[model samples]
Target: MEPASETPTALLLIDIQKGFEHPTHWGTSRSTPSLETNVASLLSAARSYNESASQPILIIHVHHHSTSPSSLLHPSARLPGTETSAIEAADFAAPTGTEPVLTKNVNSSFIGTDLEARLRGFGAGQLVVAGLTTDHCVSTTVRMAANLHVLGDAPDGEGIFMVKDATATYSKGGFDAETVHAVHLASLDGEFAQVVSTDDILGRVFR
Candidate 1:
């Protein structure tokens, strides 16, 4: 299951921050109990592939920071003393210094960021996306990535993939989090992106 593009591919991690992990603040059940472990595994594989690949695999980290002080995601709301928003180090598979970190204020990473241009600049024709909130930020970013016309080509299915096991969202209203996660995965599969497990990605796509 190698990606369709011969050009370099990127591992795009979206919104894997600490604020989302707070059960009291975020209030969501995960699709998998091993979400952090799976994400770490996939990230390790991506790093290994990047080191060996001649085409240069880029690892990009996308995080969300609330622009408004009133927003729950605002650093002031989460940690009073910290002026900067940070990825939750306890849970995050930390990125190397060479990897670029992109911050976004909106659900779609591309809306206020240069992520699309940066990917194109790196000659990345395909992307594997993994991160928090399967039905929100992760889903939104994957859809935008799928729609991107890289190298003068039309939007295609090969452009992006969603790592199912590596992402989780909180349950909302009466719907369970697992159900929400599954429904979004189903919607994206065969359309915006291929929904795949971390093992599938590591064994097939990254290998």
Candidate 2:
């Protein structure tokens, strides 16, 4: 479907699936308890970003379908009649009619999916990305979006937007989840993305 915004910015939600919904899935620990809620709010704000505009902001869901049989995200791992499945999108961020749902096995959404083409098709020059794992898939997609120059080449993920509170990550090494999350945001801010909060995005980008 065509974008409903004059500016035509795309909201790219990466790996916002049931697989990583709870901390138990990721060693039972994660940083942001409000990640899903923040993203949901973002989605709502983006959809109604410009109510009077002819077109609204385009929405794209990037799902991670793991090819590895042992991985939870793999299709086979999601058994029938289960309470939740790894591949299913979270309730708050599920795609609606006509919204594009791009699946990928790798971290970067642009790697093997038609995400780039879809963005180009929708004529969304700017991208606002939010989803799972600040240092993993989210980081990879942001870096790729900057390097790919979809929003023009200035390097250091200048044109793209990354929601700080809307993304989360698990603890690893000697660090805690909070530190890991903070560090990733700091690393990506300016260097890989704008890294703004959900409220900030709603106020600025949508406005």
Candidate 3:
């Protein structure tokens, strides 16, 4: 196993927001198990590794926000008197001081956000990515990872590493789940990112 600090890896947890409770976020009308279990397991595994690792894991949680009128994700939206937004507290379980959250309006975490700068600040060369909608935010972030240059002038760019089981997508969307899931993995594997699993990742860290 590579030394943790020397490895320069970070976990990219994207769009785990509570607003996804409805299908509107996925261009649908209802939610599915994708929002509940798969991503939850990944988060648990990540937190476990963080607790035991010699070097603390750097977690960058990406939240989606919108300014568009009538959009549920609009910046003016709220869940009542609470300061918590759906993106703020939903499906969130980060060890205090370990995960720094980044809010974004775009699908790609690198686009219109401080994600790239924050990743470099944490010295992350490899990214372990997980989150909602296999066809959307998760996929977009992975794509951006492949082209993200450490410095625009640098020859080689930092690559994206995707955790397959760590991600989930709603089943009732306009697209078919089996086909959409398979295609995303196939397209991402090798060309843009390396598709992996939660166990595959934990094995590297634990043993």
Best by lDDT: 2
User: TM-score winner among the candidates?
Assistant: 2
Each candidate structure's TM-score, on Cα atoms with residue i matched to residue i, is 0.87, 0.89, 0.77
Estimate the Cα RMSD of every predicted model relative to the unseen true structure: 2.8, 3.3, 4.0
Query: Which runs of model 3 end up more than 4 angstroms from their true locations?
Result: 1-6, 23-35, 78-84, 92-97, 150-159, 171-174
Whole-model Cα lDDT of every candidate shown, in order = 0.75, 0.80, 0.65
Candidate 1, 1-207: lDDT as tens digits: 464235567888888776665564566465667789988987887777777676766788887888877665665555434544444433555677888888788899998889988888887766888888788899888877777654237356565778888888877877888898889899999878878888877776676
Q: How accurate is candidate 1 locally (lDDT)?
A: 0.75
Ranking by lDDT: 2, 1, 3
Per-residue accuracy of model 2 over 25-83 as CA lDDT, tens digit each: 56547988889789999888876664565666778898999988877788766533475
Tens-digit per-residue lDDT, 21-94, candidate 3: 55445554322344346556656766676777776667778878876745556666655455556555464544
Selected candidate, larger lDDT, 2 vs 3? 2
Model 3: how far is 42 from its true place, Å?
A: 3.3
Candidate 3 Cα deviation (angstroms), residue 162: 1.2
Which of the predicted structures, 2 or 3, would earn the higher TM-score when compared with the native?
A: 2
